[model samples]
Target chain A: MAEYEQHDHDHIEHDHMTIPKYIGIFLVLVVGTILTYFAATVDLDFIFPGANTLVALLIAFTKMTCVMLFFMHVYWSPRMIWLSAVASFFWLAIMFSYTMQDYLTRDPGVFSP
Target chain B: MSSHSETGKFHYHEPGLQHQFEDMGQQEESVSIGMWMFLVQEIMFFGGLFTAYLVFRSKYPMAFAAGSNHLDAFWGGLNTLVLIVSSLTMALTVYYAQKSNRNMQVIMILLTMAFGATFLGVKTIEYRDKFNHGLVPVQGWNKRIKAETNAEHETKPCWEVDHNAPAIEHPNPRGEFQWTDCSLVKKAQDEGYLTNAEKIGYFSNGEIDANKFRDKVRIFYYLYFVMTGLHALHMIVGLALMTWLLIVAWRGSFSEDYYMPVEMSGLYWHFVDIVWIFLFPLLYLLGRHFMHGG
Candidate 1:
């Protein structure tokens, strides 16, 4: 058992993420949460119908970046993993934008006939 | 270490590579690719709901605004904070697991579970409050304004000359009126539409309104329940995964080399947390403009 453990230990690096990095990520998320709440309380309707949504999405995107880069270890991962992650988001955008274009631009009056 | 050397230019795969993989690097790449593919499908799942929200909000902008105002921001904000904190703990757990610190991994996993439970508990309180007030979207429970008046007559023996005296006209008998029992059945009852005792029983028994509310709120609560409830369910799953990981961590299953499971699970948990971050604002904060009458 000990020999197997030693053999396993030799291949893996023991030190990458440290306590400071963890604390830093935690602080960033905390700031994002606070900002989201603050933005929600403000009246941004004059800007657009979905201004709050945009703000919220921006914060969410920031939070996701933190998670993907830090928690998922994509920063240290090979290029292929990073590319796959980016590709997933690209496909998601295509799916969302295309479907929403059809729904948002349709005239309700067209169905009356 | 010299086994490869003694084999004389052997091109063996890395030990971590599964039997079917061409090499260790290929195996890692495949696993990462598979996870990304799964995440893409998750995006599509959430995308369908987002599209629905867009269509509905555009159709009934005012109604959607009115509906969004009903959600309490404090609870929503608190839940957001809780999930963010939990994500931090999950990341830390993976970090410790990678370091071969079994004790730290267990501690962080337990902390993450505690945060997850806190979020669900707060959500339960919010749901109960919505049900108590007739904010739950149901046929009769949607919105009902009831005007109740009570007259209390006290007769003193010396002050009353005639026992059969005409009842004094209390023009506006102001009694303690509350929004008590303002549900679908009570709304239907006040409307005087259904007189059948059986029908009244059906409505008044709380079953009909509850069902109506379920159906009506089904759209809102469907999204609400489906999204928040699904997020809560994910939290539960994360807790279970953490427990299993914790047990293994306790047994020293993860080391510097073998902590991929812990790392991958943490990534998933963090993604779930990020979903809630978006959900909080979309569901709870988008319509604050209508709160003060738009």
Candidate 2:
């Protein structure tokens, strides 16, 4: 595999997001943020025990995807760019998995708990 | 870096190209790819802290929740809103930069910088408040200061103040707890929700054991400072980059043909925004409702 791409970046149509579309995404992001704030203060745990972290993380992930796909122009990007974006998360997962192996399974009281 | 001038194909050569690439499109893609690579490393850097935060927060849910609540959600939430708006302007700046619209591009970049400054401003206020209360994670930081300060709002609790103009709570044993539900525990005890032994274990002299909470609270501040401090540092870097871009844009540097700087900087700015999107919930919103009892 080549380190650099061969495709003409200029020849390719750069489907830049329209101003209105960017505004719409911004509105959604704002609303999603407010919702994330409120949802944290609600007892989602009552609905399903220990789901607050899950709900919070899920919302965060959604917001992250929006930013990446639209704000970062990932949605209009080519395969290499998309793969690069996914690669970052993949690397993050590696860090999380190995680290959590020790953290989640370790003795909780080791930290003066 | 190789001399990009001599080795290029029959190309739309721009002023910024090094002696390394085939053409402008390839050069721009290379720049974008390089930025993403840097961003990947950035994710790892922050990932280390997030992992530590997760480990500790899980180990000390009560302390973490209580510590998280000490932070003013209004400021954190307002900063989130501010950053998102900044991101919109940033994306617009890049868009106009690609169109070579100098006025809109400069305006949007300025707006983005203003928003970024606003975020740091709000952060400075929060940091000052924490410092005033001695919430610094290192030496001279009073680990108990937050709980101590929050204890003064015993009747209304700290959050009730946030619902209003959010008057500052003082240091007093009775005014304890920022989460609304700690007051509930007090209420439950008052109305006799617990058995005598439970009351004895959970409370002593009609108050929760604030001493038992010291270490966890300290850990919370450690995570808070490491994460948010690093974030603020990134904002500072972004602001510096924006200042550079603003100066160059003022000199009629970027155009539809050569706007790599604007695009790359926008990516950096958006990456910071995305990190905050995750950070806000993890740091500010984690366990907010469920840990209300904390």
Candidate 3:
């Protein structure tokens, strides 16, 4: 078999991210942080017990989306890369939820004692 | 160095190949997969603490809310912004490295390290303030210092006036009455929560009275220290990695095809920033809800 030679393409056909896209992601992250802080200050007791947690999780998910899509270059990469990351998250959710079921159901005072 | 134009396919099986890998792509894939696995483990590590926080808060909602109010949101917000900026710089560093721009890569990495350091510095200031104000959890954990000070000053007795003088005098210039050191411990000793032998040992060793000062609230401080300390350690490790990368980058060791190390390190740095994004709100902002009466 012949050795494969590296080819130099002056015009690389890969999709490149623009500076504006990066700036847009950064702006969204900033807005998300501010909104999270604002949400924390709100009196949402009437809404639910963990309203703040829910709002925070939503903001965190948004931020994660921005980071994964833009900073990690996942959007520019092959479909396989994106699939792997999503798979990892899926596994993580399974692990977290399974353990949390047992944890949430335990005697509340067990640890305190 | 062989030019890519001279070869049809990039020769990645050079001397840098680790013993475990058959080829470059496979090695790269395995390394990335392994890193992802480690990151998953890290998630679980932090997840356990988060679950604990949730359980305790649910059990003692009032105490947790009260604890939350004491956290200053301004610092948390500023730190979030700082970490985001660091993430941007880190991403830029990877971008520049991919383009084989050595100077830009070095500059971006340095900027990222600077931001990480700034974050740790701010965190140090916040932790120190908490320590000095006795806001740390132990046993007899002092409540919010500002609120307590206001309350104490509002009811302080006038020293120069007669007993019949007005009950509420001018705000005490000295502010809240400082609790006498170890007095609570002495009270605890009198109450039999602590044996006389333990009291003697505490007094002799200058150990704080456990019974009087037993603020289980200290548990919060313990969590604060563990989480923030672990985060800070990650930042430190990132800074060190960047510093090493800076030296190599300055020496012009990387090119378009061989910038994988820098790219991988950037991924790690960005992950750290992501952790801080979650931590800032959970640790600092969550408590701000108490400021408005429920």
Candidate 4:
């Protein structure tokens, strides 16, 4: 194990996230949650239809980014790790878009007898 | 290398390091990548359900709105907060593990488990509330009240109340899924904005049928139960993970040189938190504005 220690001192990288940083992220997440909760109370369809859903989703996306980057440590991970992490979302997008394309493009009248 | 093998040790040996790996860094990398791949698959697993939700919600938005309107956002929001705090504790557990602070590691793991239990506890309360209100989608699964003493209260839909607010009860005779509010469907019909799916789904012979609308709302609750039930199942697994982590951490098994287990489990805990982050807004918050005179 001594050789392992040598490599650790020489090659291994540690992110060493500070307590304050974690606390900051936690506070940000809490605020985001609160914002999402209250945002649903206001009828923002006057501004634009589905504005509330868009805003909530936007906030959720932001919060998810923070968790994945900082909490999950993708921010400090290697390039390949970043690639794999991002690839999941990329594949998810494809799944969502392709499925939505099929559902959204169907002629409604075609189903009617 | 032969001599080292005879001595039951290798030149690159580290605690928990497998013989196949040349060094700890290689092992850590391989394990980390493996965990990420597993999580990616998990995302896709839940993604299918999400797509189903999107499709159905887009088709029968009024039914979704009415169903979502009844979910106590207060309980859902509180659970979100509980989960976030647990994630913080989990992250701290990883930090302490890397610091080789055994006591702190044990404490943090315990705290994480505590918060996880709190989340599950809150879910139990919400599920029980659903049972009392006959919100469980499956027939004969909810609390059954055969009497008609609840006739006056039948028409009254419960307002979404904040934390610690007393739960209002609804009576169901046959212990079936019940959705009394059809106001949103009526509004859509009156506004002439009903989608094609809704035009057929909610209407019976040119009139809005309450039972037909209830079926659509049942779809919403079905998705709700499946998604959140799977999430809760994950939390249960997470708690089981913490149990293992706690035992090892208490034995002082992890240290600065070998804390990969802690880190990997932290990834899992945080991933669950991320899922809840999305689930909260989608399941509880999205359709809320419809309740406010929309």
Candidate 5:
């Protein structure tokens, strides 16, 4: 099994991405960006207040996923690599969640200076 | 190293593996894991700034909205597109590196650098516009602002203040224009906009006296400078890394087996692009009900 895995790993041709797939991902990314710009341009506050920011963030998240999955090869990478990549974001979430606990409740007057 | 390659027991030879590693696969895996670890630290670093920005923006929503309106979205959008294109080129550079296509790899890297430079150029133009409007934060700058604001009381736009025009000094413009909560009291009151006791310049003695309000909006500029300034610094570092990559790549140093440099730098570039992805929307899209004003 170790020998078989080495044979697969040492060959670059076995799992490399083709040019067309990369080009397709690029085009999709461009469209996602344009869609995000349009979403920001139109006010959606009447549907629900803060909907505009909501829309912008959702579209940005979509675009980021595209970059991560295809451009960064997270989709095709092994489980170990995927875990490493996901761990970074998980740690980032922890940092944000804990910091915001203190930040969101702080009195406005605390920043008067 | 030569003996290990001849024995064929090591799939990846000793030259690719440092003495401490069992083999090249282990060495490469650790390197990959290490890069991700570094990127995690980077995310946390930027997370602190974003958190601070969020807290201030929540506390001062209207001020933030007004600040957001002042930024031009078209240029910000253009930068977003440019950065996305740069990421595409960068990813392609990595692809070509893995294929051992030296010329295409070099070309893609140069194209990425060009887009990065273009992003910086657009940013410089935006910064220059802000300076011309006297929006930069400098100590004692509000003194000039007071004279300029008072001079503009005669239908002159504060942004259009002439250096040659005679200066009229207003007593305590900082205190006069800025109060505890009132953003534009004298101007808003004159414009017949009803205000609560906050906009009114009242001291503890019940007498109307300027205490401090003119510089509250400057906080927005302070945040803007810190965020975009750090971003520009990152672009500078990315450019320097690209220059080194260019030299080594031109020397035919990268190939299918040795493409770690290209892959690592591509990760860094995409990370920067992702940062801009968040920034463009938050800063440029926030209170632009429509600058077209149609």
Candidate 6:
């Protein structure tokens, strides 16, 4: 039991995120924000309709991932904790998918005429 | 070291360890799981709003685009940056707490609180702008003007891009929500992507109706207010959490053995930031391409 306690301490110490790493992720997030802002200014509809929205969402998703992993320290968390985090997102995706499926497949003709 | 209670059973006494938990590791894991569960529910709470936005936006793309175009991206972007920086400070506070560096912990907490306040300050400016422009959806909730006789209070054309069209008075006599631009409807007419909802929603006698279009735009502004208002409320709660953290850190109450409070609070702060990360683009950036004629 004493050895088990020491092992747990050493395991957590190994997982500690460095201060520099935190700052690095911060810089990445700031750059991602600026990039998304400028990306919105340029007309990307030439690529495809709603292309601009897609690009902006992609950038935002990237920034969110950085925050969740580094700033929130989920990267250093144990397996169960990380699984729960991912599971939350999975559940969110399920909600979005089901809701969107209903809306996207609806016949607008029913609402009008 | 293990001690004995009166009954002679083993009692492991780690600092900050609850009696229910077998060890510090177990205690930390349990608390973290609990916090994550709370955040999961929070995501769903906000997720419902996002679903509403998606449905309406898809139904009336032009209206959503026009309404989104009016939002000041500069202010939204500034708030996004502010929240991101605050998350950094919050993460640093947790870092310093783990190192037993009380002074740095206090300083970082103060910095986090300052940034959180700055974000809320920016929200106040944005909300006030919405009120002044008669963009609030509720009746009698906007800035009311009694008369337009004053030279400085002359009514101006309500263009979608009027934020840059010089200072002009928006006279709202009955404090009703005001929106006059229907250019997106015209554009959609030309492009032929206007949905049947928009067909019935924005037209009267085969002609585009400004009032009908305005009502659709009103939906966009309504979601904008509710989402950002709730986000700002969360930031206020984060500030309160930081204030408590400041007092405890100043008292040097945390060390390597006990910094879970700081970590948990940091988790919450970053979660709030993540929400704004998605909100800024969805609200302010998505429809900007429409204005650029993309």
Find the candidate with the highest DockQ and give its number: 6
lDDT string for model 4 (B138-238, tens) is 99999997766536644433222232556545566789998756777766777677888899998789877778889999999999999999999999999
Model 5, residue pairs in steric clash = B178-B212, B178-B213, B178-B214, B179-B212, B179-B213
Model 3 docking tier (incorrect/acceptable/medium/high)? acceptable
DockQ score for model 4: 0.57
Which candidate leads in lDDT?
4
Q: Over 4 Å off in model 4, which ranges?
A: A1-6, A9-12, A109-113, B1-12, B149-171, B292-294
Error of 1 at B205 (Å): 34
Error of 3 at B213 (Å): 12
Q: For each predicted model, how many residue pairs clash, with residues at least 3 apart or on different chains? A: 3, 10, 16, 0, 5, 0
lDDT of all predictions, in order shown?
A: 0.65, 0.74, 0.65, 0.86, 0.69, 0.84
Those runs of model 5 whose alpha carbons end farther than 4 Å from true positions after fitting are A1-14, A106-113, B1-19, B140-216, B290-294
lDDT, candidate 3, at A58: 89
Give the runs in model 2 whose Cα sits over 4 Å from its true position: A1-9, A107-113, B1-16, B141-209, B290-294
DockQ values for all predictions? 0.28, 0.46, 0.26, 0.57, 0.39, 0.59
Per-candidate interface C-alpha RMSD?
Answer: 8.7, 6.3, 7.0, 2.9, 4.5, 2.6
Rank all candidate structures by their TM-score, best first, as comma-separated numbers: 6, 4, 2, 5, 3, 1
- Reference-based lDDT, residue A29, model 6: 96
lDDT of 2 at B137: 59
Candidate 3 deviant stretches above 4 angstroms:
A6-15, A76-84, A87-95, A106-113, B1-24, B138-216, B292-294
lDDT of 4 at B258: 83
The CAPRI quality class of candidate 2 comes to acceptable
Cα lDDT of model 3 by residue, B1-294, tens digit: 222232324443443345555545555566666666666677667767766666544443433443455567788789999999988888888778778889998899889989988998999888766655555554333323333454543222111223244433323232321221233234334544443333443343555533322232345556666777888898999989989999999987776656667867877787788888888877777756644222
CAPRI-style quality class for the chain A–B interface of candidate 1: acceptable
